[model samples]
Target: MGNYEQFHLIVKWKEQALMIESLLFLFLNIILSDKKQPVSSTPKTYIYDT
Candidate 1:
């Protein structure tokens, strides 16, 4: 029973770590996309317009 409790605690800790990591990843992606979207898309639009 003690071992099982330890295992469960480890699993829960790992899950929380993974959740935080993924949330950070998603946040970074959103920030990067916002920064890149205008810079990347404007050139294409200008080229097409010209």
Candidate 2:
């Protein structure tokens, strides 16, 4: 029972971490895409522009 509880807690922590990581990744992608526009000389470089 103790081992099971520990496993559950670890799983919960991992899920929260993954969520945070994904959010950060999305933010970075947006920032990077914006930065690329000025350097690339292309008009439609924004990925999430749909």
Candidate 3:
């Protein structure tokens, strides 16, 4: 096996690691935004002023 060559698996792992990191960042932003700001929870009636 002296002539055998080694295949690089680092590239594959690195790609996966980067993808997971981006997803985690997005998830954290979503979680934090929901806590800091709240969207409308109910519908509002429009009032017309003459």
- TM-score top scorer: 1
**Candidate 1 residue 22 C-alpha distance from true site, Å:** 0.6
Cα displacement (angstroms), candidate 2, residue 38, comes to: 10
Give the 10-residue window scoring lowest on summed lDDT in candidate 1: 41-50
Name every residue pair that clashes in candidate 3.
none
Model 1, 1-50: lDDT tens digits are 99999999999998888778767766765787788753343322222111
Candidate 3 stretches with Cα past 4 Å from truth are 1-7, 37-50
Highest lDDT: which candidate? Answer: 2
The clash number for model 3 is 0
Q: Could you tally the backbone clashes for each prediction?
A: 0, 0, 0
- Candidate 2 has which clashing residue pairs, if any? none
Q: How close is candidate 1 to the true structure, as a TM-score?
A: 0.67
TM-scores for all predictions: 0.67, 0.64, 0.56
lDDT of 2: 0.69
> Which candidate, 1 or 2, has the higher TM-score?
1
Model 2 off-target regions past 4 Å? 37-50
